[model samples]
Target: MVNDDPRVSPEARTRVKDAIDALGYRPNIAARSLLLGRTRTIGLLTVGSTAYGPASLTLATERAVSNTGYGFRLANTVDVDIDSVENGLSLLLDQGVDAVIVNEPTSTFRHRRHGLAIPVLSLSEPLDLSDVELVVGSDEAGGVKEAVEHLLGLGHATVHHIAGPQEWPSSKRRREAWKAALEAAGRDVPDSIEGDWSAASGYEAGLEFAKRPEVTAVFAANDHMAIGLMRSLQRAGRRVPEDISIVGFDDVPEAAFLSRALTTVHQDLAVAAVRGVELLMEVLDGGREGGTIERVPTRLVVRETTQAPVASS
Candidate 1:
């Protein structure tokens, strides 16, 4: 019996049949890669923010590459470090990576537009790719809108926001969605506080909110801040749901076990990684033109952290 999977090329089938008869012949993919001026390796250039999301994405890329019998290289750069990004790009090029995957969360990404000689597949918010090969990312705007609407559906008067740094395109998208949701619902949009996407930042922001007797609910951009916000609210003598309701983005594993659990947006970071790799491969194989944009959707994960605001005691 012959397996007709298109993934198994004709030459590969002949080699496999011969190898089965010989009982042990192996193909040297590395040598073949060299003959074809390729390294059989993919490079992932990641930005060093969103620790948990990027980590999950990396794992997914690794798993996908392993299953496809390809090798991968990864490089991470700090936010706003041009030198670090250039250095990482140079290293990947020197390593002869077949293609590149850009996992930076920016709308104005330059690496794929002007930097590298190889094709680039970007994992970012849907933006104009212009000359880049393919782009993959979450529909963050929609996700944020859904999350905000969920909070409104729970009967909150108005949802206050603790946003991530403005430089990140994701933060901007979520902010836009938050505003849109509020506008559509005829709710007042308050002056939002900016956080560094850290638990400490959320805690500090929560302290400010605690001082406002009218603030009974908040929407943190990420789960880490939600945790901090919860802590600060607790310290301020406010019981979650009983006094103030809270919602967060990125349903991290710990969100469920928090003091009151947490309502959050669930972004499948692993899927983003796999999709990014696949798009890179397509470009490397010349299966598609550069400058394609892809967007994956996100969902809201409701738990114990959010509810209607209680009346003032």
Candidate 2:
């Protein structure tokens, strides 16, 4: 008998009806899993807990899963341990997770998805999505272009660049965009210094870059490195903006309150996390195997760190 009580919402009734329509039994999702080959649960693997970006992403992912009314199995690794990562994934699979979201950098996660029956989703960093069903990445190139364009709009000379490791897809994209913008503007594109996505690396690079007389404007690929670069420049007797302008990517929390402030590209990590979950859930919901690439937009935030290059006395 169909119960059409006023207290029961139509959506609730519809969900119950859908289950009945699927099969003659009115079993709960857990009971139906065996018959339908669905686990009603998701797995998320993330990087070290120490990193702010990854930690925030983990929280966002958990919230997304909870909103969907699905159980989640989460694992965090302190270091890049392939064995531990694989072990954690194996355990999640044992728990009957319907899909997996791997927050590891793309390159590492790509190789690990081999022979997995369920769909795998990768967030951040570029990877060979051949194995995984879908991958979501930040639009780093667009962010770099936006940052450079803002500096140019401020009447600064061509922007110099400090790039992260060449192997990281984000770093490569930002560096390419910076160079392309310079070429398009007919500005001299100096060779960019490399950093290891760390403030110390940025500081070291900044020290050397400060020696150049023509380096009036600089852009660092990530916020940590940007701060380090700024500090190094200051320690080397260069005044930000007044002496040489600077911009950075990532727009981390500290960017605004820094001594000179920071003009940076803001990559919306929360938005990216939500989009990644959306794409991953789409695949897990028996949708068509869609294209693998999903690119989230980025924004440029103007601050006190940038100004017109001062004329050398």
Candidate 3:
């Protein structure tokens, strides 16, 4: 009755249910897995910070897994190093998960042998691993292009950039895109200041930028950094969108509510999560092949933080 066996009589099932309810009984998931030959649990191995993007993706992926009537497990890695990634994967595999989703946005897994027996999906750039079944990522290049173009269209001679850690593939993509856009428009590409996807790092970068009087427009890799950069600029008596226009990535919930609302890129993390699970399910059902890559779209949200650069006297 606990296993929902149709062979059990209705009266027996009712009695068993009543007894279970009275005793607060719980079925043994391990025993169930032994009998069914499957755990019906999906595991997620996330690498890196608890930043808004990673955290939101984790929640969205969990919800998508739950909506499909499957159990979910999570394992975290302290860093994107090879040892940390392998340890995280081993933890998930030890849990006997049906499949694994690796939210590793770094290049640690590229061209490496994971030796995973179960299906694996990645939420980063497409990797050359035979064990990885699929790859799903956001259109970071497209968003960066839009932001750079918007700033250039506002008559800014060039747009400066505050990039995320160079180790992350997404950060590398954004930096490359920003550079490419500037080069394509015949604009001089300035050296980019790297941040650790933290507001403090952004503030530090902003302090250096504030010293450069030629900087009229700037784009931050993420909103947290943008917030810190804005504060530093304000402390230096530089008004946003007046002295230096600012653009940021990841349109977090607070982006629109800031005193000077952030103009940023919005990534559809929920859609990416749902599609990743859906593709993993297809792999589990033996209906899909490995090595498929999907890129989710992103949009630029124009807000108060961006405007035409003021004419210099």
Clash-forming residue pairs, model 2: none
Clashes of 1: 3
Writing each residue's lDDT as its tens digit, candidate 2 over 1-313 gives: 2536888888888897888888786437776687778888989987665444567778888998888877888876655566766666677778888888878632554344355777777776534434446777688888888888888887877888889877555677789999999899988898899987889999998889889877888888888888888899889998888877888887888889987889898888788878888877777766747457788898889889888777667
lDDT of 2: 0.78
Which ranges of candidate 2 are over 4 A from the true structure?
1-29, 78-91, 108-115, 125-132
The C-alpha TM-scores of every prediction are 0.87, 0.81, 0.87
Q: What is the lDDT of residue 165 in candidate 1?
A: 84
Q: What is the Cα-based lDDT of residue 57 in candidate 1?
A: 74
lDDT of 3 by residue, 1-313 (tens): 7769999999999999999999999877778778878898999988757899888998989999999878999998887788788788778888899888878766565336645677778887765544657888789999999999999999999999999988788899999999999999999999999999999998998899999999999999999999999999999988898999999999999999999999999999999999999998998878988888889999999999999989988
Candidate 1 C-alpha error for residue 52, in Å: 1.2
Q: Candidate 2, 183: how far from true, in Å?
A: 3.1
Against the true structure, candidate 3 reaches a TM-score of 0.87
| Candidates' C-alpha lDDT | 0.78, 0.78, 0.89
lDDT of 1 by residue, 1-313 (tens): 1445778988988887887678765568978787888788887777766557666776776787666667878887775456777677677778887777766665554544455566767677543333556777787888888888887887788889999888777788788889998999999999999998899999999899999977877888888988999999899997887778888988899988877889888898788777777766666667877766777788888889878766655
